[model samples]
Target chain A: MSTGNWLDARAGGARLSRRGVLVGGGLLVGGGLLLAGCGGRERPSIESRDVGSDRDRNKRRLREILDRQTEAVKNKDEKAYLADLDSSNSDLVEHERMVFANLRQFEFAEFGYNTRRVAAHGDYTFGPVFRITQLTADESPVGAAPAETFRYRLAPKDGRLVIAEITPASPGDQKDALLSGPPADEAWNMTPLRVVQAADNVWLVGDDSVPDLEKFAAAAAAEAAIVRRLWEGRARFPGDVMYLTRDDDNYRRWFSLGKSSNFLPEISGFQTSRTGVRQNGQVYSDQRAGAAILINLKNIRDYYSGEDPRVTMHHELAHSVTAQLRATPSIISDLGSPTWAVEGFATWATGVRWPSEASRYRSQLRNGLGSFKGLPSSKDFYGAKRSLNYLLGWSVFAYIAQIKGREAAVEFYAQVIPLNDTLEPFVELPIFDGICERTLGTSAGAFLEGWQRFVRRGAGA
Target chain B: MLMVAAIVGLLGALVAGVGAYLPTNRYQATATTVPCRRVVCIPVLKASAVIDALKAKGHPCEQERDHHWKCELMVGTLTFETTIEEVEGLISDVSVLVVRPPDEEPTEAVMDYLLWLAALPYTADEALTEEINDWVVDRIEADEDAEAEIGGYNYYVVTSNPGSIRLRVIGALR
Candidate 1:
C-alpha cells in the first residue's frame, strides 16, 4: 500500500460534529461531577478555587475534577456521576451510562489511576489527564502492562466548575506529550462516542438515529451481557455504546468523529462501517473508548440461521478485551500472537464450533496448500487462503490454551508483542516446541507432528 | 454401292439393339428379382436396426414410433437397406448406409472412394453418410460378383443376368 492508501485505510475522516461535541462534553461533566464529591472536604475547596481568578487556582480546580472523576468511577455512583452532565445533551447522558457500564467490570483495587496536568487553554482547560496503568485481574493475562491517558476539559457550568469534555489519547499521543511535542494528528483523533445509561449497568449512545435508539439499546444490552459472560470475574475495559448506521458514508464518518475532542486515557471507542463482509460473521475496530464489533447485517441474516447476532458481537468484544489487556504501543504493533490464537480465543468465547466449519475449510486448504506455502503479502491477508492461517492458527492456539491453559497462552502473547519480530518463528516447529516445553511442559516437535496429524485427519474426514 | 452400305448399316444397328437387350456375361447367375413391396419394408426395418446399432455404440439417438419416424432416419442424403424373411435373420446381412454429401461437387468415382473410406473404424457424420452411398454401390457390385462367382448352382435357380439385371436390381433396390 502507498503512503496515501495507508493513510486512507486508517482515516475514516469523520469530524466530531456538534452532536459529538455535546455527547463527549456531557460525559466529562457527568463523570467529573461524580468524582467531584470523592474527597468530601476537597469538594468545597475545589468549588471555591473555581471562583478564584488565579490560573493556579483554576488549574487546581481542573485537577480536583480529575481526582473526583477517578474517585467517582471507583465508587460506581452512576446517579452522582450523571448528575453533573448537561441535561440538554441526551447523547452525553447516554455516553456516561456506557462509561459507567464498562467501569463496573473491575474492582476498585484493580484500578491504578493517576492524573498529570498537561496544558491549560483560557476557559476551556485540557488535562491533568488520568491514566489506568493496570487492571489487577484480567481474564487474559497480557504479558505487558498497558496504560491510557484521559484528557479532561473543565469549564464553569451553572456558576460552578465542571468537566466540559473527556477524550482518550492514544499511546503515540502520550509519547508526543512526554517529548513536549504536539501529538500526532492521527493520535489526537481518538475519541469515544459519549456514554449513556440504558438499563441497569447497560449504557446506550446515539450510535444510530433516534428512531433506532431502542434497537441500539437492546444491542448494547446484549453486548454487555456477552462481555459479562466472557470476562466474568476478570477486570476489563468498559463496554461501549453500539453505533449503527446503514449509510456507508455515515458509518465512516461516525468512526472518525472523535478527532476534535480531548483524549480519555482509559476509555476507548469502538467504530465500524456498515459496509464490508464480516469475516466469520464478525469484524472489529478498536479506538480509545472500546472496541466496536460490526456485524454485517446481511451476512447475519443470510448465514446465521439461529438469528443470534450476539455471537459475532462477543467475538469482536473478545478482540477488544484482548486489546485493552495488551494495549500495544503502536497502532500497528503486532500483539505477537498468531491470527489463529486471536481468532480462536474470540471464537471460543463466542461459542463458535470449529469442527463444523473445519471440514469445509480443510478441503479449501488441501486444494490450495501449494500456493499458500509462501508467506502472505499484506494483500493476501484478505484472500481465500487466509482462512487456512486463521483455522490452523486457531486450532494451534486453542490446543496451547487447552494444554498449557489460557493464562499461559495470553502471557505468551503479551511477551511476543514487545519483541517486534515476524510471526514465522512462532508458527514454526522448533520455536513452538520450545515455547510449549517451557510453557506447557510438552515437546514442541511432538506438538507440531500431532497438530499436523490432527489437521490431516481433519482434512481426510 | 449406296444401297449395299445402307443394308450393312441397318444390319449393324439390328445387332447392336439385340446385344443391348441380351443378358451380360458378368452377372448371369447371382442377380435375383425381389418384389418392390419387400424392398420398401426392408429399408424401414434396416433403418430402424441401424439406429439401434448406433445407439448401442453410445451415440445417443431419439427413437420415434410415429409415422414420421422413418423419414427422420434419412437425416443425410444417402440411405441403403437389406432384409431377411424372419426379421431376426435380418441382422446377418442387413445394413443401412447413411451418406453425408461432400462440401464441393463430388467426382464420378466418389462412390468407390467412399467404399474405401467406410472400411476405417471411426467415421464422422459427414464421412459416414458418404461412405453409406459408396457401400450401397459396392453391395450392388457384390451382387454382380456373386453371380459371376457362382456361374451355375445346381440346387438354386438364377432368374436374371448382368445387362438386364442391373436395371431390375436398381429399381427394386430403390
Candidate 2:
C-alpha cells in the first residue's frame, strides 16, 4: 500500500546509542578485543586454527565490524561508520553517508542491532561471503524497516570483513550477482543521468529524450510547496525527489514490495520507505533513509509519457512526510490505519482538492452512498477493486477537511489511527464506529451521513 | 516481394496451429467435483494437510474451539496468518486476508485445498466461480459435474471416488 524500496538505493544507517553501547556493545566489546588481538585481519587466525575455531573466529570478526558500525552510530562519527564499510565502494560510502545525515536530523536516543544470524557463503564472486540475518532498531519518531528478513553480505576486502551488499535481495540476486548482489551504485538505472537543477528545492536527474524528467521534478517541487503550504508551520518535510529511467526488471528488483505486481503502469512512481529521509531501528534500517523519488521510466516511455508524475510524486511524498507517524514508536498504528484514511488523506491533499475537476469519485460516491456503511476493512485495501477504496476514502477525508478543518483532520487522523491487534479477515464496522466517536465526536452513522451530504454537494457543484 | 510475403504467411500459420494445440495453461493442481444437492459439504485444510505444504512446513497451527484455525507462518520474515473458516462442522472457506507474503508462493496443494473448501455447495453461480479464479493463481473451472479438465484446481472436483459425492483435492502439477 505504501512505497516499497525494492533493491533500494537509499543510503541510511543505524547503531546503538551511547547507552546502547554499554548494553548491546558489552558482548561486542569482548569481540572487539578479539578483533584487536587479531589486528584487523581475520585470515591469520582462520589459517592458524582448526575449521570449527576458524568459523568461530570468522563470525567474531564479522561481529567486530557490526560493533564498529554500532559504535560509530552511537558516537555520531561519519568516519568511524565508513571505516566499517568497504571504502573501495565509494558509492556505498556516499549512500551510507547520506543515511548518517538523514538519521542525525532525528537525533535518535538509542540504537542497536537485534536478531542476528550469520551464514557463510564460503566463496563467492564478490569475495568470501558471510551473511547476517540482523535488523537495526532505534528509539525515535522516524523508524527502521524490519518488515522482511535481510542479510548483510560481508566479503573480504583488504583481508578484513567489509559490507559488500544488502538491498534488492531475492533468490535470483544471490545466483546472478553472487557476492555483490546488485551494485551498490546506480547499476539498476544503467543510464548515467546528468543531475540538473530545477527548483531551489529540487534536483532533476535525467538525460536527453527524457525532457519529462524535469517536468516531473517541477511537478514534484510544486506538490512539495503545496504540502508545505497546507502544513503551514507544522513539522518540516525535507527529503527531495530523484527520478531515473530503467527496464521493468529493475523496477521489480528495486521496489515491488510483494503486495503489488510490477510492470503495472498503475504505479507511476514510488517513494521508497515510509520515511525516505531517516534511518532508524536495527533491521533494514538503510532502506528507510535518503528517501529518493524513483520514477518507472519504462512505464512512462511505453505509455503515459511521464506527463504527470505529479499524481504519484504527491501521493508518495505524502507518505514520506507522514512516515514518522507510521512507525511503531509513533502513537498511530500505521499498519492498522484504515486504508481509506491512509490513502485518501494523500489523494485529497492533491487530486481531490479544490473544484474537483472531472471527479471519478463524484460518480463513485453517487453510487457508493447507496451502500455506504462503516470504515473499509483491511480486505478492502488489497481487494481487486482497491482503487475504489482510494476514491471513496478521498471523498471521505475531503469531506472531513472541509467540515472539521484540514489541520484538525490531519491531527485527528494521527489520533484515531491506533493499533488493532485483531488477526485477519477483518471487518472495520466496529472499529470505524469507535474511531469516529472518539475522534470526530460522533457515531459512524453520523460520520457517513455527513460525508454523503458533502458528496452530494460536490457532485452537484 | 510476393514470395517473401507468402513465406511469412506460411510461418505465421504454422506458429498459430502449434500454439492452438499446445496446452498453454499449466495447472499445478486440479480436481473434478459434483454439486451438493442437499446438505452442502465444506472442506477446510486438515491441520495435518497444512503442515504437508513444503514452504508451510513446520508452521505451528492452532484450531480454536469455535472451529477457526490460525497459523503464524513464515518464509524468511515475511510473516502472515492463514485463517480457515468453517460452516456447519465442515471447513467452508480458507482465506489469508491481509495478503500472502510474495516469496512464499503458496504451493498448488495449498491453493487447491483452499479452492476446494470455497467451492462447496456449488450453486452454479458466477460469483463463486470468480472467487475460485481470484485465489487459485488465475485458473477457473466453469463446468459442474464431469471430469472437465486436469487442472481444475481449487474446485469441489468430482473424482474417481463414487457417486455425486464431491471431494476436495489438489491435482498434480506437470
Tens digits of per-residue lDDT, candidate 1, A1-461, equal 12232122112211223343344334434543454444332221111112233444555565555456566777887776566665556776777676665565443323433332244556465543434423332212222222344565655678876656666554246353422212212111222333345554444433333334455466557666755564555545544434433333333344343442321212122332111111111111222223334333334444557444554555566666555543322345443334455555555454333355545555665665553332232223435555566555545545555556656655554433223224344445355456667766667667666656655544344
Alpha-carbon lDDT of model 2: 0.43
Instruction: Summarize candidate 1's per-residue lDDT along B23-54 as a digit string, tens digits.
Output: 32122221222234333122112334444443
* Model 2 C-alpha lDDT per residue in residues B120-167, reported as the tens digit of each score: 322122232222333232221211222222122233332111111122
Best by DockQ: 2
Reference-based lDDT, residue A186, model 1: 19
Off by over 4 Å in 1: A1-53, A65-114, A117-124, A131-299, A305-307, A317-335, A344-355, A367-370, A374-385, A395-424, A428-431, A438-442, A449-460, B1-174
Q: Assess candidate 1 and give its lDDT.
A: 0.38
Position B62, candidate 1: lDDT: 42
* Per-prediction tally of clashes: 43, 21
Cα deviation of A253 in candidate 2 (Å)? Answer: 2.6
Candidate 2 local lDDT, residue A361 = 59
DockQ of 2: 0.01
